[model samples]
Target: MAKTFASTGDTAEKTITFAEIGEGLYAFTAEGDPNTGVIVGDDSVMVIDAQATPVMARKVIERVRTVTDKPIRYVVLSHYHAVRVLGASAYGADEILASEATRSLIVERGKEDWESELGRFPRLFQAAESVPGLTWPTMTFPTRMTVWLGKRRVDLIHLGRGHTAGDTVAWVPDSRVMFSGDLVEYHSACYCGDAHFADWPKTLDTLAAYNPRALVPGRGDALDSPKMVADGIALTRDFLTTLYDSVSESAARGLTLKQAFDRSREVMDPKFSKFAIYEHCQPFNVARAYDEARGLDHPRIWTAERDREMWEALQG
Candidate 1:
């Protein structure tokens, strides 16, 4: 039998957890769903990645209210993923910030991504109609920007491209806690549909240089220790390397995409198959890796139609 298309079959709801990694920084995470980071500065709060929809984002808001009633002042888009940015409206944040590259992507393919992702993972978009439209960043920075809530300083840095052409990480200088958006996933599979495979590891290296005391990853449980932080980064690096190495080797040998996919499974399954969204991500991951290995520097835009076509071609 053919496998389910993307995460459409993943209808079960996951329990949410809100854990404090730093003094005022929190991680709002579901079982292995997309995670959101919260930074409570002295005056207001800044959210890392919004949930999939307004309804989904409210869950994060509810958790935020439990600890502090300070208004959510800023909403940060880690990259241009529908599941991460569509919930911006719910925050009612004064500013929606993203990298310039991310804003360009939104202008380029945000509408198509919204449609494609809604089809791929229906569960995440709890109230699809609630989305106002393609989320637009109210503010954008080319490389790095800083915001201060009272005296607490939060630096938003576009370290390098990894998960997407534009990926930004929020760093709390005071607590040494880093909110690494999809750049580093804990136990969950890194969705490489728009990933920069070769650049990803170098970005990871830049992130490691900070030696964050505690880190909140894009998914899975929050890493509250330096050891766990290192481990998470290492695990992400290993996953990317193993997949790219196997798929690239196949591409180098002139294997077909299907042949490359099968070969990748044989190599990646033993270690990463058990990860959340591992199956959901493999086809796209294999396709992108194959392309990059064969010299595609930029990722192709994924549309609802292309999503189905790719799934049918690979999963069938």
Candidate 2:
């Protein structure tokens, strides 16, 4: 292969920032890395999207400690990605919540995803051995679940499929603030390896209807205004659509997977080359896009072996 598989060479640590976006809502962002959301209610706190590992989650805990001593009573898993859900134990919350589909995905592919992601992006899994095992949600809901942190209310809703089949958002209706887990990204490449390219845009529409005043994205800096929120949603939509459109066009011409990958990159690189994870995501994104364009609706599970085979086929 001409290059390493996925983000193997991306070892530089990002600068973490904790910014207050609402009354007591904060976005814990690390440059373009996955972000964590904090909502402080009257007497307790709720965390959204735990980091890749317990050691990594400790950093977010440190920041949360600076602002409030209220126990983190809830930990919400936005989806079933290992990098996002494996750190639930760090919170030691009363209960961990996730969508029913998310929980099922964990049962089906969680272990495989753990191995695949760790091999691809080692930097994100700091102290990976500290992870006791696959994180499980003690509580599961179907479409929407509401939790009251004293007077404050948080609604965890599954708008539709996007980044994954079980994508869910933490919505604060009263404050018009949302924690969109990988459903929206600002100036960062959308990782579509496990994504539904066709369903993602429609789901974004569901999120936009809320007219969010502030949003904590899965990656990049927080969106603190309605305009920024809209832009983030638009950017994510554009990335997914652009990628799918390009691959669809190539596939329609009966291009092979490698040929389709090259053609799609030519079209996408000019616009997205500089985005975070652009290089790491390109090969997998195109491979999945190629499958979807050819009428494969469900994305294939990606194990470590499949990851290597796909990388070599496209990047070699």
Best by TM-score: 1
For 222-284, candidate 2 gives per-residue lDDT tens digits of: 999999999999999889998999999999999999999999889999999999899999999
Q: lDDT tens digits, residues 244-300, model 1?
A: 999999999999999999999999999999999999999999999999999999899
| Residue 89, candidate 2: C-alpha displacement in angstroms | 0.4
Give Cα-based local distance difference scores for all models: 0.95, 0.94
* TM-score for predicted model 2 compared with the true structure: 0.99
Q: For model 1, what is the error of residue 259's alpha carbon versus the real structure, in angstroms, after optimal superposition? A: 0.2
TM-score for model 1?
A: 0.99
In model 1, the clashing pairs are none
**TM-score of each candidate?**
0.99, 0.99
